[model samples]
Target: MKEFDLIKQYFAQRGHVRKDVILGIGDDCAITKVPDNQHLAVTTDTLISGVHFLADAPARSVAYKAVAVNLSDLAACGAEPAWISLSLSLPSYDEAWIDEFVNGLYELTEYYSVQLIGGDTVTGPLALTITAQGFVPPDTELRRSNAKPGDWIYVTGNLGDAGAGLDILKGNIEASAEHRDYLINRHYYPTPRVLAGTSLRRTANTGIDVSDGLVADLSHILRASGCGATVHVDRLPVSSALFDTVGAQQAYRYALSAGDDYELVFTVNEEQRGNLETSLANANVKATCIGQVNGYTGQLDLRLYDAKYELDKDAGYEHQF
Candidate 1:
């Protein structure tokens, strides 16, 4: 099938309709209207086969991740996702694969009440790019640079599951079928913390989505905020599946260094922490306080009882262009 035909058949108008969309697919550009007194938050992510996922990864998973990761970015900024534009490149026109991909992609966008705008499809190495747009109230959006010293650090959900999932897929680890499936599913279908992020705007001083390793992504916050932090090794929320499958030491490493878990890492000062916790609790999110911001500049210390260790800067997967 031709590229345009493939896109029209599988993707056109699949995203849920919203009043703000002036024009969606089959146009030179998708036009949208931003509500009054609100700011638009936009983010884009590119996923490549063999790099982002296994070459044989399910098309549904690939499509889902493409959307989830970008939505996670919107969540970090305390925005509600409203629109997405997908640019997909496929090596060949496989009907079943295309159907599955659209099903997964549209399922997520529809769930979030986001509309599909416009994009292009082409023949090439398997890759997908999504540009997501969200909205936040004017003059108050969470940012990585807004964290302050003495603010407590918190993360939603357990960490390292996705990294462990990848390890399982790569044949680098062993586990029973049930445990393996759990880990693999976590890696493939991550929940973006949109509601939690929105709640954070009222309490969190700064935040980021855990796309890279916890330490690496936290470093971005530290650098931007011109501060350091003290993370407790014992406080890392290792999932039971990961802990049982790989034990404490390996689980700790994965939680600290593994990526692809789309949880939120945020900061709240002592004064606002109560409200923050209450808000997240109301939203039914599981969160834990891991540590606090420190005065040191651009350094992160992981504390385990009486001992402290500097995280290896290169520990996580660094996407090299």
Candidate 2:
């Protein structure tokens, strides 16, 4: 099939979309209107075969992840996701593959009420690029530069499941049937903390998504805020399945360095603790206080049972150029 045919066959539907999207798919460029008094938030992410996911993995999952990771960034910025554009590159077209891939993409967009606006298709070693845009109230968007030294640090959802999931997929280790499926699903279908991020926007001092593990992502905030942190390893939230399957130490390693979890790590002031709790409650999400912001510069101090813990500074995934 030709490129335009592929797009029309699988992705041309746009009957229902947010009022902001004036023009979507099939146009030379999509048009959107930002709400008055709100700031436009945009984020983009690219997923490459092998590096980001297993080459033989399900196409639907890849599409879902491509949209999800970009939306995750919008969520981190405390924006309400509204639209997405996709650029998919493949070696060749397969009707069945395209169908499944589009289905996965629609599933997430439908859930979030996000519209697919415009994109391109090309022949290449498989890759998927997504650009998502949203709106956040002016002066209230979460950022990496606002954390204060006395603020309490918190993280939404458990950490390291996706990291463990990836290792299992790569066959480096074995897992029980139930645990394997759970972890694998966690890796493939990550839940972006959109609601939680929105809820925390007015209260959070600073925030970021855990795309590259806790330490690395949090470091972005620390560096931007010009502050340091003390993250308690003991406070790291790991699923019971992870503890039972991989034991504590390995779980700790993955929680600290394994990337792709997409959870939100944020800080709240001591006085705003009540407000933070109330916001998470309204969002029906759970968050754990993992540590505190400190005075040290660009430092990440890991604590284990009250003592300073150490790990590879190279922890977490950094795309090697």
Candidate 3:
């Protein structure tokens, strides 16, 4: 089928449209008017077949994940997703596959109240790129460089679920049916902590999403803020599903080094911790204080009982290309 035919038959007008969007798909450009009091925040991500995802992955999951991950970037910066543009490069257009994909994409965009905007679809090796735009109040956006010494480092939700989930997919371990389903879902669908990030905007000294492993992604905030951290390995939260599927050691490794959690890792001051918790609680977000920022001149430490260690290396997924 032709490209426009494919969109009309399956992909066009598939999601909710927010009021602020002046134009959506079928336009040369999607026009939007940002509220005068708000700042626009935008982020983009691309997923390629056989690289970011398996070749035969579900069409729905692929579509959902493409927008979801980009929204996670928005969440890290405490932005409210308002619109998104999709660009798909494919060998050929297939209406059935496109329908399922658009359905999945619509599900997430609608749930988040984000509108579908403009993008270009081309013929090529399979690649899906999405650019999501969001809004945050002026001067209230969270930044990786804002953390300071003595700030309490925190993370929303449990870590290592996606990492452990990937291992199960590779057949690295045998698991029960329930365990397999749980882990697999963890890999396919990661929840972006939008509410938590929005709430932390006024309180968090710095913030980042745990797209890479916890240790690795948190280091971004540390490096940007010109500081170090001391995380308690024992305090790292591992989900019950993870512990039940894989033992503690494997789960811990996933928590420390496995990627794709899409959770928020942030820093707040000691004195404001109670108020921070209250804010998160109001947003129905759970967060844990895993560490504290140390002085800029000293090395970061992860205190394990009486011992400490340094996490100063490329500790995340290595992508080639």
Worst 10 residues of 2 by lDDT: 312-321
lDDT of 2 by residue, 149-186 (tens): 98999998889999888889889778999999999989
| Candidate 3 Cα outliers beyond 4 Å, as residue runs | 296-298, 309-315
lDDT of each: 0.89, 0.89, 0.83
RMSD of 1: 1.5
Provide TM-scores for the models.
0.97, 0.97, 0.95
TM accuracy, model 1: 0.97
Stretches of candidate 2 above 4 Å error?
14-16, 318-321
Clashes of each: 0, 0, 0
Q: After superposing candidate 1, which stretches have Cα over 4 Å from the reference?
A: 310-314
